[model samples]
Target: MKRDVTITNPVLQGVFPDPSWMWHNNEAWLVTSSFGQVPGLPIHTSRDLSHWQRRCSAIDEEMARRLFLKYIRTDNHGIFAPTIREFGDAIIIVSTVMEVMVDKALADGADPDEINRLRAANGNFALVSRDDGLTWEGPHWIKGAVGNDPDFFIDADGTTWWTASRPSSSPRWPFQSDIWMRKLDTERWRLEGPERIIWHGAVEGATWAESPHIFLKDGTYYLLAAEAGTERRHAQSVARSDSLNACYYENNSRNPILTHRTLGEGFPVQNVGHSDMLRDDNGDWWGVCLGSRVVEGYSFMGREPFVFPIVWEDGWPVFTPGDALLRRRIIRGQENTRHGYQLGDIASQEGKNETDRDRHIEQINPNDYLMLPTQPQWIWTRVDDFDYEVLFNPTLMHEARIQQNRDVFASITTDSDSSSVVACISNKGTVQEIGRTALHHDEWYSVRLVGRSVRFAQVPAPNCIPNTEHPLLVGKGAAAVESVAAGGWPVINGGLDIPDSSFAYADAAFLSTESAGGYIGCLAGVR
Candidate 1:
């Protein structure tokens, strides 16, 4: 038999957290939480679990409008983790609307009881789709599920069951909770039977027993959950019982079935947990979870989706057997599988700045731009910088081109009378002003730097739709300079002293690791 080789970890990348997966018609469909980000609850489809593509957003415009009108604002307040399921011909998604007060409010003496009361008003709601997730209807309130991270389990007898992490009646700590379950009367949209506490984590002092997903395997009911919160100590634990209503559950002998908590700061991947499990077409068990990619203990990409294999031993699920730390790579049935879109591919197609040299580019487009949630490639100077919001709206397009051992060009348009400078900064605290533009409200402009010459131009808006147009110049530069150094440090009062234009000659060496002096490389954008 020919073996199939596949890499099965990190099935999806970049800020896709709290993953929930369901296998349907030989295809795997996955959904993740989109906290405070409109077009929320992103859905992805995969065939072999290694390669995936975003299909459509479950939270539609009408849903977003309703949420905005009811919740007041979006920012850690909208949708939490979502559980996706296919029952007969209907697809159901259960997600929590988190409207709790911010931590700053609590620190500033906000009453916990009042915060809880406001949060209680926000509960789990279900959206049903009859056409294989193309269209959805009815966010019917699941009144019984009082907390976040709600998941659904349809029993073998065709009875619908609901399980969620219910907040503790009395205060202990944030996310100190227990798993609860109750049978649902789908017609009435209410709990049919008595609600019961399922499991309160295997570890004695585990604070959060959340993201509970129940699965039935070989006549056993298994409950898998994430514990120790979503930080460095995040982990996956499993418990098995003979019956759904079993008064007690037996914790897996090899508890914390999956985790990277012990990997320390050296590992590139950390905070591994908040998982959901599924069996593939090959009958091999696999898991999808969230983990962060960190560089020297700093992670800006947020939690991402990763997949791992599960092996059963002694009637228990064992994750990545004999290894406590999750590896960056894993081998599956070898069909010669490749996963994820390469940076080169995304740059070539989405960037519109194609060149022969190895270059990575980020273009500002309406589809990919949002006000509340920051884009992935952007690294802001401060948390409160809302400049991109003003620029991205009204469908203004911008492009940044970074060619290795070459020059960097950035083109931006603004609808505000704000003056901003885009520059190339080195790791050794050196700043080279690439382009500067005086952007008036509702104007289009281009900034270019080649060799030692720098020019700024007010151009016509490119006659192209967002995400489809190539970077093209519309007009000539009004101000041209033979030597950029004559600009006198370009916004010297703003920050970083460049002194002279000699720095532009050394553009090739600007972003090198030796010059940057860090585990990560250099960054270029609006500052």
Candidate 2:
């Protein structure tokens, strides 16, 4: 037996939500939702539970184009929660491509006639990987497997059952849901047999009962689910039954086995739920779930994946150990420490220089980049700063072009299509362009942007497009654009030092996940 080691809560960081865990060949494999990010469905492998390395995305370029290209128009609109499991020699994944109805339409009192017409592309599907998730095949639409967070339960007798969250036929309230199950025909890739509604939720009037997983212990079937709407009241609960297809009774004594809602607002961690349980080689119970780290009433990194220890007591699972709530740190038996990977903490750590080995940086080249098999570094967001480090004061430099005066281009910009090449800043969901400029089109030019101002220059090139005359460099009125960054938002400053108020100036915090308001943080990628 190995001793327990105290490890950080989120083993995988930066917007990795709804993690599905499985142990294969002594290695831990996990997958998370990408939610419309190209080359979606990221797969991560870890030998030591503490350190995880991204292997690849399950949905490749071909799959993305064929399945999600046209459908994925907005953030959090693509891949929902996914469940990965080992069946025989192959590994299988069951998930939903959530093109579900948007809430805004309902709020605006859109015609009900267009509701189903708009939700035609929403459903559950499965993918298989014979070579250990390196590659995948067939979305093999699981017809009739409706709803979100589809999970697989492989019985001892080789029966594979599928369960998912769906709107209850007998709805007691709006957004009320139920967990249902049916036999999955792996060969035919569809659901067969009578559908059984297993559990509603632990709370009396809980809404959005989702992310259900089943476990068989002794002769009792345990059904674990996430309920309470996945917001401030998000929580995990369990139910049990004697027969596989029988009615499951909620663990009335200890229904919500895990949650941090009781901790109130501004706790270190909040929105904890959507857990998946797995037994280790040492025969100990462990679980993985999604949680958001709150800072000043905002979550910038979105919901990240967290791993914790669980214990079985009186036929129900207990989360953490001494404390029944989510913890910033927890202890777990250390096993399989072969893979030595650690996430760098440049943003939090002190005394780390630009060239310091502790500094974390990633650079992406767009020309050679392929949308399929997207490298783990490529994530969805407004701007992702990889190797480009902007600790307190930052500077951004890049080459850009504008086809027309109506089209604006500079070293960096919130929107390249905006008419003016000006200094701009966004605060509280409002964009203000401070500086304005005009430049020649179909030409190559160098651009540099700092916290207070921006600079541009026209450089002649041979093989590249024609050249043009651009406005000279200058500075801004404010000596330095003061900035405060929480999480990974870069604080850029110091391109060409000149006093000019025309360039855009902004506080780096204005570009944080708090301001963006979505499931993903700011991502640095060429689009």
Candidate 3:
């Protein structure tokens, strides 16, 4: 098979993490964890693995709210990693709804019983779609797999299997876990046979041996999983057995088949684990995993999707060129080739009079105002979809000239006095609020910022200084000079009040990379 000379590293950008893929009807369909964001489980489709387009969300807000009410206002509490597979004519998505105990819940006086109840609520679910993934039916709850990152597999003989990470009965550490597998009774939508602890971590006392996925090749069962937690040390491990119900499985000689953890903070892609593999139409093995692009030891965009080629050696799948920093351009096998334009062509195009005329025309406008469009370049905190209209752009970088001009402006209106539109800049790493102001409700307002000065106006009226003594611009360093803004409820008295309704109109020219500090620059949008 031939390979493309270069492929982009992150096939899908932004906070799409814990990727799962399934090939159906001669095309690839992928899904990722939403983590309490509404419209849970976004699905994307691609003919070639290199290019992808979002098809539709597998679960919507109404469905998600009905299924996981405990996730409301909870950070990192909702749809964990999902595994997509084709069982006969139906496509099945097995996933977990995680509502784990956290410091915030403890600080708010949550008892052990309440935490246990939340844990009990966290279980695996199966959603089936028949019409080539256009619509889904029945998030039919699966009882036995009581853990996070569930993987569903169907054997060649038509027997269904389910696997997940469960709290270790004899744990070595506080939250030690092991991967378990069981036969699924599809007719009843539950596990039928006894649960078996198939494989643990590569090391005896390894932690977080989760994200289990099972595959069969040439009569050998390949069980793949992620272990060592999802931080700088995150990695993917594998095990294999001759029989599906083998008493013990053999760990791969090369245990951590894929990871960039040891490459250090200098490598752009960090936290590389939680992967899923697929065989392309051309019979070539390919895999997709989650990795974060860090800058100066900070990653603001969260975990993004990365793709790599896989090769089988000695009956075991090896991530080709095992230990190296994932590059921005990846090369893969392909057939057809189209090499047309080069740098010189781009220079010639730029020299054209029409190009200069177009540039001059756009400059005459001076300001570029944009409303929330159908497909905007916005990366949400966790959830993919939002209820209100929000214009978000998260691609600003230090090299990008967002601070060419000193003046920034915004027009906004709110439904409640407590609700306010905020415009400010801060570092992505700390998300520190630099230049910002709260707008009054029920009136059209405009926010203007010129250097260190910030002003607000109720349209028709002259701009006035804010009555509140709180400084909108408070941070230090480059973050202090750069500006990004969000319009919603302000943090009042140390906590935020969720408003009923709020709206903000923005101009992108004023939102700069300098204001939005952090590793991946600042995210400018409305909350």
Q: For model 3, what is the alpha-carbon lDDT of residue 56?
A: 75
Candidate 3 — which residues are off by over 4 angstroms? 1-6, 100-122, 173-175, 322-325, 335-524
In model 2, which regions exceed 4 Å deviation? 1-6, 100-122, 334-411, 414-421, 425-430, 434-518
The Cα error of candidate 2 at residue 60, in Å, is 0.8
lDDT of 2 by residue, 1-527 (tens): 47545556577766678888888787778899877665577888775576777777888767664454334445546788999899799988888876633455456565454343334425577889998877788777786677889999898888999999988888998778989999999898778999888888986788889999988998888888999765679899888887888756556568788888887775556788999987766666678999875444444446788877777778778876555655445445535432111122333432122124332222222322323122232222222111121111111222231100101122233235653333334444354555545443433233323332234333333232211221112111222212323222223333335443333433343333444544554332222
Q: Write the per-residue lDDT of candidate 1 for residues 420-524, one digit (tens) a residue.
A: 433332223333455444544355443333222223444444444233242222211121111111101110011122233321223333332223222121122
Per-candidate TM equals 0.67, 0.71, 0.66
> Which candidate's lDDT is highest?
2
In candidate 1, which residue pairs get closer than 3 Å at backbone N, Cα or C atoms, i.e. clash?
4-333, 4-334, 4-335, 5-334, 5-335
Error of 2 at 123 (Å): 2.5
Model 1 RMSD, rounded to 1 decimal: 11.8
Candidate 3 Cα deviation (angstroms), residue 308: 0.2
- What TM-score does model 1 achieve against the real structure? 0.67
